[model samples]
Target: MTVPVRPDARRNATPYLYGREAAAVARVLESGQYGHSDVTEQFERRVANWLGVPEAVSVSSGTAALHAAFLAAGVGPGDEVVVPSMTFCATIQAILATGATPRFVDIDPDTLCVTGDLLMEAVTDATAAVAPVLFGGRAVDLSSVQGEFDRRGIVVVEDAAHAFGSRDGSRPVGAGGTALTCFSFGPIKNLTCGQGGMVIPRSPQEAERLRRLRLLGVVQSQNERADITTYHVDSFGLRYQLSSINAAIGLAQLDRFATTERVRRRLWRAYRQALAQVDGVTLVDVDVDRAVPHLCQVRVPRRDEVFAELRARGIGVGVHYPPNHRQPAFAAWRRSLPATERAGAEILSLPFHQHLTRDDIDHVASELERALKTTGGS
Candidate 1:
C-alpha cells in the first residue's frame, strides 16, 4: 500500500527515519558509553566498508570535517583556498577556521558547482587548496586538471556534504582516493547521524592525522587512555569527535541507505517529470542517474514573488544560498561573480524529502505553475 504524504508540502526538507533508528539509539543509551566509544568506531568502520575505502574518520559536524581536512593538509595563515561563492556559508566559515583566506570563485549556473577551468583560473602561487562543493549531490570532476594541482602542491578538499552516495564516474564519490572528501550526516542529508560527519582521507597517515585532530590532539585511544596515567597531546586539535549516540543513529541509517538512495532518486525523477509541465522553471540538473539527489532546486523569473506566492499557498520553497562574496562577513574576499549573483537571485528549492508522495510533488508543481502566472513570470 502507498503511504499518504505526511503533513502538507510545507517543509522544504526534513529528516526521514527508518524504523530501526530509535532502537539503535536506545541500544547505545543502554550501553552507558555516550562519548566516542566502540559504537563510534564501529560506525567509522562501517562507513569505510560501505565506501570501499581503507578508513573513514568521524567528526562532530561537516564544518569540523572540513576544518580538520584543511589543517591536516597544512592549510594555514596566508594560504588561500579557492571555492565557489554560491555554496552555503558553512563552507567559507570552515576555510576561515583554518586561518586561510578564501579566494571566492563563480559556479556553473546549471550545476551550481565550480568547473575545473574556474578552479584553475583562480589558483595562484599562494593557493594551498581548492574546495569544490558537490552542490546538490552532483560530483565535480577535476581529473583533467588534477595533475597540475598536484604539481603546485595544492590539496583537493571536496565538500561532499550534499553528496554521500553520489558517483564521480563509476566509483562512489570518495572511493577514488584522490581528494580528501567530507560527508555530512546532518539531520536533512541523504543519511542522518542526527548530526555527524566523516572524512575520507587520501592516505593512512592523513587518516591518522584526522583522528588526532578530532580528539583534541590525544594520541591514545579512549580505552588506552583509560589505562594510562597521562595521554600525550600530539599537536593542535579540536573536541570534534563523533559521539556514540549519534554514531548509533548513523549505523541504523547506513544499513537502510539502499532504500534511501532508491527513494531519493525516484522522487527527484518524479519532480523532473512534473516540473516539465510547469512553465518558466529550470530544474537544476543533479544527474539523478548517478546522484542520490539532496535537493530539488529550480531557477525561475520573479523568484521572490513566486516564492512568496508558493509559501502563501502552503507549499514550501527556499533559496539554497545567497552568494557569500556579497555578504558583509566575507566582503574582504569578494570578487565579481556575475553568474553566481544571477543564480542566487533566481534559485528556489522546492519541498523534497522521502516523506513526499507523488501527489505532493504534483501539488507543488501545480502551485508553482499558478504562482509563476500570478507573479507574471509565465
Candidate 2:
C-alpha cells in the first residue's frame, strides 16, 4: 500500500498553522493591547457561537475550564465530582484543584466513556458535580442522565477536550440544551490554539461567574475591557484567562473549521472502513457519522507490541489515556474498574489528524496486521 507520510509525523501533537495565524499574532503585537483584550474576546465569541452557546469564557487551559466550571457551580472542598477513570489526568487534577475529591467511575466498554448510570452510582450526598467526557470524540447521550441527575441536584459538565468540532445528530456537543460544556484548544485537539479552553455556561449569570473566576475574581463588567480599568474584587480567583496570543491562533483554526473538520471526518471514516476488515481490532462504539474524532483508537490484541511496532514503522501512535485511577497522584482513589482496565490494556491510538490521507490509513492498517501476528501478539 502507498503511504502518504506526514512531513512531521515524528511529533504527534504539533498543530498545522496557516499564515493567518501569524497575521493575527502580528496584528495583536501591532495593537499593543495584548492582555485579554478585544481580540481574545472576539475569539471567545466565535467559539461560543460555534458551539451554539449563549456565552463562553476563555481560560488558560482545559483543566482551568473544568476548575472554573466546578467553582462556578459551587463545588468545593469535600464535594465529590464523578468522572470516568479512562480520561486524561487533567479531569482528576481539575477537581482536585477546586478542592474537591474526584470519584473515578468505570466507563461503558463499548463507548469507552463513562455512562450516566456509572456517574449516578458513584454519587453520594457529597457529590456535587458529574463531568461526562466525550471519549475519543464519541458523543455522550446525556438525555436520560441529565434529568435524573438534575433532580438529585447534580451539576453535569461535558468535557469536550477531544470533541471540539463534533456534534450529536442535529445538536452540537456544547449547545444550549445540554449541561455546561468545556473544550480544550491544546495543540492536539480537533481545533487548537497552542493552549486554551472555554466554558459554555447555561445562563448569563453562569457566564458572568465564570468570567470573574477566570480573571482573578474581579467584576467582569464592561469596565475590564479597557486597557486600564478599575474593577472591584469580589472574591478569590486564578490567573486562568486565555491570552490574546493564544486566541489569535485558535481563531485562525476556527476560520478554517469547515475544511479541517471535513478532512478529519474523512480520515476517520477511512480508518473505520479499513479497520472493519482487519482481525483482532475493533473501534470503540460511536456515531461515526456525527463524530469529528480527535483520534482513531482501536482495541487491538497485544496493544503494547503493536504500539511499539507502529512507532518503529514511523507512525505516531499514542494511548489517549492510561486510566487516571492508576496514576500515582490518585493512588488513594485507585480501585478495580473492569471496563476501564480492559480499555487501558488493549486500546491503541493511530494518527487521525486533519492532514492524514486515505493512503496513510491503508498503510497503517496494512502495517498493523503485520504487527498483530508477531511473537507475543494475538
Candidate 3:
C-alpha cells in the first residue's frame, strides 16, 4: 500500500512577477551599475506617488527601514516605543536596534491591532514613539490616536509591512501621518522584490536625513566630483540602501499590485462567506473597502489541532505570529498580555493569495469544517 499525497495548498503559478522587473534587472546587469542608481530613484518616485507621499526611500529590508525610521525620528537609548505584543518580532527588534525599549501593548481582538485605549495606558514620560502595526492588511485608524500622541509630543510610526495597499478612509497607509511609515517588499508580502523595504518620510527634511543615513551618513556635494569629497557625517548611520536590481523588481510588483489586491479581497470574502457558520471560528473584522487583505486570519478553538489536520490533508496553514513579548530576547518585556496570548493560541491563517481559486477555498473550508468536527465541535 502506498500513502497518498495531497495537492499542495501553497501552490502559486509564476509568483506574480512585475512586467518590467526582469528587464530592469537585465538592464542593471548589462550597465554594471549594481549599487543605488537611477533605477532606485525611479522606484522611490513610483512608491511615493503610489502612497501620495512627497518622498520614499528604498532600503535593504523592512527591519532596516524601521530602524532607520526610529533614528530619523530621534528615538534613542532609554526611550520607550509603544508596540503591540501581537506583532512580529521585527517590530520589537527594530526598537531594540535603535537602543530603545519596546513597551508591549495589548491588541484589539476584533481588529487584531493595538487598541487606542491600551496605547493610552502604556504611554509614559519615557515614551518617544508608538508603532501602530497594520496586521493582515487591516487598516488601523491612527487619526484619533495621532491627535493623542501629538498632544503628548509622541511620534507615531506605522509598521505597515502587511499593508502595502491598505487605506484609512480615503488616504493610503503611508500618507497623512506626521510620523515615519515603513513598508516591506519581502517575498511573502503583498508586494514582492525578493527582499526589500521602504521608508516614507513625513517631510523633505526627514527624507534627506533618511537618504544620508541609508548610505553611511555620506552626503554628496554639488560638484559631483569624487576628487573634491565633502566627508560630512552629521549622525550615526547604516548601509541599508536597496540595489537597482531589486528596485526594478519592485517597480514591476507595483504595476501588478492593483490586480493582486483585487484577487486577495475576493478570496477573503469567499472565506468569510463559506466559513461564517463554522462553529468555534470567527473571521477578523476588516473594512473590505479600504483593506487589501494580506492574510485571511481567524480565531478558532483547537487551533493547533485544526492546523495539524489542515496540514495532514495537504492544506498549508500559518500563524501570523506569536506574541512578541513572549520571545526569549524580549523576556524582560514579557508580562501578561491576555489578548495577545489568546490570539497566539487561537489564531489560524488560512491559505490566501492571488493564486488561490474558488475551488481551493471550498477545499479549505471543507477541511476546516472536518477539523472542527474532529475536535468535538458539533
Candidate 4:
C-alpha cells in the first residue's frame, strides 16, 4: 500500500485491521446498549489495573479527563492552574471549562515540559494546581515542582496523555505522585479507544468523586437511593462518561499495548540512529529505556520548510502544537514564554506509530535529511 505523504492525515494504526474494528463496532451495535454499562465498567477496572491506580474513570475524551481532574481536585472559579503554554489548545480549554484561569508557564528547552523554574515563577496566591504534561512520552523533572507545591499546599494534576506506559524513576506515570494523572485514548495516541480518556485519581475518595462526577454525580450503590424517586442536586456535574463501545475498543487496545510499545521503541531507535548524523537537528530528550515514546519530535531551525519538504517527498510530519498562549482565546493570559515560543517555532514531529516499518523509518529520515539540506541547514 502507498503511504500518504502526511502522517497525521493518513491511517497509520492497524490499517489492515479496519475490518476487525468495524466488526467490533458491529458487535456493539448488535448489543443495543450503547452508553455506559458493564463493558465501560470492565474497561475502567482494566485500565485502573494497568495504571496501578485504585480507580480509573473513563470519559468522553482527553479534554474531559483534564476537566474532571481539575474539578475532582477541587479547582474552581477564580483559581489559577499552572500549565505549560507549549501544549495543545485542549489543555487550556479544560482549565477554562472549570472556570479557572490557566497561568501559562515556559517549558524546559530539552524536555519540552514545564520547567521547575518557570513553574515556580508562575505560582501565586490564586494558584490552585500545577499541571505538568509529559511531552512526547519523556519523563519530566516534576519532583522539584511537586516539592514546591507540597510546601504551598497546591494540587498537582499530570497531563500524561503522551506518557502512557512511561516511567519516572522506576515508578509508572501515574504512580508516586499526589497529582491526578490523566491519559488519552484518542485514535492517534499510544493506546487508542477510538475516542476516550481516563483519570487516575490520587486517592480513593478522589477516585470516588471522579466516578460520581463523570456520571452526573450519581454515586454508585447496590441498593437504590431512598430518594431515587425524588430529584436532588447536591453538586454540579457533567455528562462525560465513556460509551461502552469505546471502552471495549480500549480493552482490546490495552491487550496489545505491550507489543505495540516494543514496536514503537524499535522504530524510534531506528529513526534516531538514521538521523543522528544529520546536522542542525536535535532529538527531544527521553530516557529510551524507561520511556515508551508516543511520538518522535525533533528541534529543527527551519521547521516549516522542512515539514513542507518532507510532505512533498511523501513523508508525514506533524507539529505537536503551537503555543497555547498565542491562540486567540488565551491571548489575554499570554505572557513572555520565551522557551515555549522558541520551541513552537522549532519543533517538528516525525511519523511514528506501531505500524511503521524500518524501511518507513529510513524513508522518513532520508526525506528529513533532504528537506533540511534543501532548506539550507548547516
The number of the candidate with the highest TM-score is: 1
What is the TM-score of each predicted model, taking all chains together?
A: 0.98, 0.94, 0.94, 0.92
lDDT of 3 by residue, 119-193 (tens): 888999999999989898877776667788888889888899988898878888888757688999888788988
Which is better, 1 or 2, measured by TM-score?
1
lDDT (0 to 1) per candidate: 0.93, 0.82, 0.83, 0.81
User: For residues 1-378, could you state the per-residue lDDT of candidate 2 as single tens digits?
Assistant: 344444444347568675698898888899887778778889988987887777889999899998899899898998988889888888888889889998889998888987767887888888889989998887887676788788888898888888887887788888845577889989878888889998889899898889888888878544444656565789888889888989999999899988877887777788888888788888875677888878778898778888987787678889978999988899988878998998899998887676666776787787787778763564
The alpha-carbon lDDT assigned to residue 338 of candidate 1 equals 93
Residue range 153-264, candidate 1, lDDT tens digits: 9999999999999998999999988899999999999999999999999999999999999999999989999998999997998999999999999999999999999999
Q: What C-alpha lDDT, on a 0 to 100 scale, does residue 117 get in candidate 1?
A: 96
**Which digits, one per residue and each the tens of the lDDT, describe model 4 over residues 146-257?**
7778888899888989888888888888876477888898887888888999888887888878877887776642134543765444567788989988887877777777
Clashes of each: 0, 0, 0, 1
Residue 37, candidate 2: alpha-carbon lDDT = 79
Ranking by lDDT: 1, 3, 2, 4
lDDT of 2 at 313: 68
- The C-alpha local distance difference test score for the whole of candidate 3 amounts to 0.83
Error of 1 at 366 (Å): 0.2
